[model samples]
Target: MHDSEDLVVVVDGELLTNTETICTGMKAQHASTMKLLRKHLKQLQTFGEVRFEIRLNPQGSDTEYAMLNEQQSALLISLMRNRKEVVSFKVKLIREFFRMRDALGQRDMTLWRQLQVAIAQEVDSAVRASFGSRLMLDRKKDKPILQSEIHRLESEIQPGLLLN
Candidate 1:
């Protein structure tokens, strides 16, 4: 649930604006907009930038609506009757789309960094486990080898590093 009236959602790496939201933003009736979209479905599909989904309504009824990416959304807006409200809505939608995109990018970057840290930790743990096994197998004979491995691992996992 988004608080912003002009909120645009990101679905499967694409910014999506549904028919209802578009109609509301444009100050147009939902039925009219849906009709227009259906009438022009072929043209929109030819653009290769829009997706349509069949979703179930809250009342358990099937409903079909077009989900448009940024490019397709812009194109659709351009093709619509150019009212002041529609133009203003288009501007807001574009802005929200970019903002959502940038936020998603930042989130992805953060998740990537976390994954790296997790992998490093797993590597460090594996190295320690190997060292422990070697120490148990050769308590005295492999002391030097174990020491060297420990030193290498310690250097690799320096203080404040990801592994540490």
Candidate 2:
């Protein structure tokens, strides 16, 4: 079987599958699938959040589609009886769910590192720009106070670097 990653959509940091895709995968009629979902809506909500998102078609018509996260999808699949294909498909979907989650986690870590590097560069630049000629020692009386202020600013920007 092919990977089902393309069939999954990420919505607001949650991996979701549309009812049309799930119905197609399970070889069930769309109406029947939707009926089953509505019947168990309460129970499914207890399991996890289920949402319906509205989208506009090319014809300017609004269509509401059900979106299910991994937990909700698994729960819905479990409710289906005597569907052998659905059982297998559920297993595959769950694996893909976790793979997507890991990918998202890696992306978050990369973004966090980039942010840290950006902050460090900005702090370094600010320190250099502020300390240029303004910190000259010709003004001996204000030199000590300026130096102490600079030290405090540096410590605030990056902890544990007190000047010797």
Best by TM-score: 2
Query: Which candidate gets the maximum lDDT versus the true structure?
Result: 2
| Per-model TM-score versus the true fold | 0.65, 0.68
Give the alpha carbon lDDT tens digit for every residue of 1-164 in model 2: 34576668776666888776777777777668889999999987886778887877446887566888878888887887756898877777778888898988787666566556655654555565567665333344454555555555555444455544
Lowest lDDT 10-residue stretch of candidate 1: 155-164
lDDT of 1 at 76: 75
Candidate 1 lDDT over residue span 39-152, tens digit each: 777787776755677888667988777788777777777778988887888788888888888887787666566556655655555555577866445545544554555454
User: Cα deviation in Å at residue 63, candidate 1?
Assistant: 6.3
What's the lDDT of the predicted structure labeled candidate 1? 0.68
